[model samples]
Structure formats: C-alpha cells, structure tokens
Target: MAADALPYPLRLQGSGIVLREWQPDDLEDLVTMLDEPAIARWTPMPSPFDIEAGLAYLKRAQTGRLSGRRIQLAITVDGGEPLGEMLLFGVTGDRREAELGYLVGARHRRRGLATAALTLLSGYACGTLGLGRLLLRIDPCNTASTSVARRCGYRLTGEPPIAQAGPYGPTSLDTWEYVEGLPGPRRQRLRNVAARRYGRRP
Candidate 1:
C-alpha cells in the first residue's frame, strides 16, 4: 500500500490504553525504560542506552513510517505517558505480511498492557491494513512473552533453526504466527519465510 494510504500516526485504543506515535517528550521515559537490564537482555537495543541512541531511535521511528516499511507506536494510557512501544515492521505489501515486536516498561509489566497492545495492533493490521498475517519471535525462555502471544491468538510454530541476536549475542528463539483465517499453505509459507530471514530452518 502507498505511504499515504497507511496510517502513519496510527492511533489505537483499548480498555485503558492507547497506541500512538512517539513524541519528543517521551525521550526520557523511553531511555529509562530501555536502559533496564531486562529490556537490554530481551531486545536488540543498545546495552547502555543514552540520549544519543534515543534520539536516533526517534528519528528512525519517524522515517520508518514515511518509508512505508514500518509503523512504530508508543503504548500509553489515555494518551498520556508512554508505557511501552509496539512496532509493525518488515512489511511485505504484496504478501500482506509483517513482524510484530513490543516492549512494556518495567514499571508497567504484569498489568496486561502488552496483551492489550498486541490485540489493538492485531485488529489494526488485519482490519485496517488488511494484512493477511503477523509474525512474532520471542526467546523460548521468556514465559511472559510466550503467554502473551498465546493469549493474543498466536500459535506456536516451533523454534527457528537459527537463534535471535541480542545485545550480548545470539540465542535460540521461538516463532509464533497469528492470522485471522484458518492456517493453510499461506501460513506455512509465512513460517518458512520468517525462518529463512531469521537464519532458522526453513
């Protein structure tokens, strides 16, 4: 789809949460949340996140939207302070496929924000964007994330052949697939494509 056709500053609302584009004022919160050891360990973020890195990320978030390749949104409550972030990246227009990634702040964990954000984004992707499928890669040991995926209707498709690279190094990862329709050859194709892209067994 064209860049203008897609929602750049997409805004999604849930029970008590809203997913909207990032703002300049969010830098401090973003850096603080991403600087946590847990966040660094789980995500591909800079080990020692600083203002510079945060600024760069903010820039990329804007550019990514304009490029029509990604949509990065901040998860907040009532359009207030940011609680976390959600992204729909690596979008393939013809195939109607994209990858979903999210991280909730340490202070916001265990409050169902992650699941709520996922559900909102899933609806926007399948309903607004007309995406056929969405993919998620999580470390197998991350029980919280695994649970969130399951709760969001993402089916376990097994581990990938290769591992996902983190700040420290690479580690084994699990692949999950979520789609609105029944699983078929198209779902399998998405699995294979994701596996290959992530250096996993295809």
Candidate 2:
C-alpha cells in the first residue's frame, strides 16, 4: 500500500493510555527509557542509549511512516508524558499481517500500561487497518512480555523460535501471534493463515 493510503501518525486511546505518533519532544523520555539495562537486554534497542541514538530512532520512525513500512507511537497517559513506545511493522500487505513491539520505562513497569497500549494498537490494526494478524516476537526468558501477550489474548503458534540480532548478540526468541475477529469463519481463516505462515499446526 502507498504511504499516503495508510494512516500515518495514527492516534488511539484506551482507558488511561493513548498511542500516538512520536514527537521531537519525546527524545528525552525515549533516551531515558531505552537506556535501562533491562530494556536493552529484552529489546533490540542500542545498548547505552543516548540522545543521539534517540534522535536517530525518531528519524527512522518518521521515515518508516512515510515509506509505509511501519508506525511507531509513543505510549502516554492522557496524551501527556511519554511512558513508553510501541510499534507495528514488517507489514505484509498480501496477508494483512504485521509485527508488534513495545517497551515500558523501568519506572512505569507493572502498571498495565503495556497491556493497554497493546490492546489499543491491536484493535486499530485489526479494526481500523483491517489487518488479520499481529505477531509479537518475544524472548522466552522475558516473562513480563509473555505475560502481556497472554493478557492481550495472543496464542503460542507452536512454531520454532527464531533468532533476533540485538546490541548484545543474537538471541533465540519465540513468536506469540494474535489473530483478531475470532469465534467464527473469520477466526478460522485467520488461524489457518497464521498457522501456515508460522509453521504451526492448523
């Protein structure tokens, strides 16, 4: 799909959280959050994240949106104070599927913010964007992320884990795939497509 055809700078709101496009003003919070050791270890972000890296990331996010490749949003409360970030990328236009990624700041952990962000993003992808599947690639060792996936109703596809290259090195990661529009023919279709794409049993 063309970049103009897709919704760039999308904004979604939930109970207490809002997911919207990244802003230049979010740089400080982005650097602070991504600088956490746990965030670097679990996510693909650069180690020793700094202002420069944060600026680069913002630039890439803007470019990705214009290219129709991804949408990266800042997770905030009441549309103020960025507490985290989330993204939907690696979109497959033919399959109507995309990957989901997110991280909450160290101080903001365990407050259901990530879950709320995921919920809003998934709803937008499946409902507004009319996408069929959303895939979350998570490290099996990251129990927190797995918990979020479960809470958001994502299922284990039973597919073999794959390796993701990060700042430290390559680490094996599992795929937690979410298929929306469940409980009917659409659900079965999504399940079948997910199974086939991820090498899971149908």
Candidate 3:
C-alpha cells in the first residue's frame, strides 16, 4: 500500500501484448498517439504533440513512478515498437484506489490493442497491486474508450460529469468504477481471460 507498490521498469504482459515503462526511444510513438485531432477531442492530451512534449512527458512519467504518484507505460507488441500507452495514476494516499487511462495511435485502432492493454493492466492492478478500486474518467462521447472500460468490467457510477481543467484546456469527465472482488459475470469472465492469457503477472 506504499507508493513503491509499483516497481520501476514495470512490464506486464497478457492478451498478446506487453505494457512496459516508457523509454527514451519511445518518444516518436508517444507523440504519434497523442498528436491527433481525435486524441485531443476525446482526451486531455495536448494538441500538436511533438518530440519536445514527449520528452517532457517521459520526465514526468519517471518522476511519477519514483514518487509512487503514478505509472505510465508504453503499450507494445513483443516488447518492440510502442503502439500506444497505458497509465495507472491518481493513486490515493491510502493506496486503496487509482485510475486507469490509455490511448492507441490512429493506425492501430480496431485491432483490439486497447482492449488487450486494458485487460492486462486491470488484472495487474487488482491482482498484484492489490488496489481496492480502479477507475477512469473520460468524455462519454468517446465510445471507443467507454466500450473498452465496460468490456474490462468498469461501470459508470451514473453521476454527472465533472468539469475541470485539462492540460490543454477545459474538459468534462464521467467517472467509471472497477472495484475489486465485485461479483458479476463480466468480472468473472475477465478473470478467466486474464488467467488464460497472463499465466504470470508481474
């Protein structure tokens, strides 16, 4: 339940993909995923995301991991080129809750990478990290991400969207929750999927 609950150079693999910590060489891929109209419209990522912004992001990711505030990982295949990113952030002081976020490049949509990446991270968070709850905030209009969250057993709390300042501009976000030990068919199914794919979680 400490900030160090997340190890450095973290690598979690499952559902035919690998999610690992960011590296210096991943700047291009990182920028590619963030520097898009849809990414900007749907999420809080910066517009005109470029190499320089990616460098700053990498530094923040390292600091987040070391300080136990958050963890940002690159979603890749076979540990090769980065396809996108996944994050576990907003870890509460009690270490009982956190948030999940992800993004895939424009070319990589519809390939199920987002779903696979979420499933892997969701399992790692609830199983190994032992967090009591994991949640995500997003605009309801982003059906792609909303679908991924539901498929991974997150349910909308039915509360109103919260308005806040994003890194780029004003944003409104809907909250969804995925609590540990929640009894339901979808939860069980995800567990089965994780077991079948992630024989070892680390």
User: Using lDDT as the measure, which candidate wins?
Assistant: 2
Best by TM-score: 2
Please give the lDDT score for candidate 2.
0.81
Consecutive 10-residue window with the lowest summed lDDT within model 2: 193-202
Q: Show where candidate 2 strays beyond 4 Å.
A: 1-5, 183-202
The pairs that clash in candidate 3 are none
The lowest-lDDT stretch of 10 consecutive residues in candidate 3 is 193-202
User: Using TM-score as the measure, what is the rank order of every candidate, best first?
Assistant: 2, 1, 3
**On TM-score, who's better, 2 or 3?**
2
Choose 1 or 2, whichever is better by lDDT: 2
**Candidate 3 per-residue C-alpha lDDT over 11-37 given as tens digits, one digit per residue, 9 for 90 to 100:** 888889988888888878788778888
Error of 3 at 192 (Å): 23
TM-score of 3: 0.84
**How big is the positional error of residue 84 in model 2, measured in Å on the Cα after superposition?**
0.5
lDDT of 2 by residue, 1-202 (tens): 5743457758888868988888888889888888977888887888899999999999998888777788888999888788998888888857477899989999998899999999888888888788877889888788798778767878666678898888777778887778556667655654565456444542
lDDT preference between candidates 2 and 3, better one: 2
Which rank order by lDDT, best down to worst?
2, 1, 3
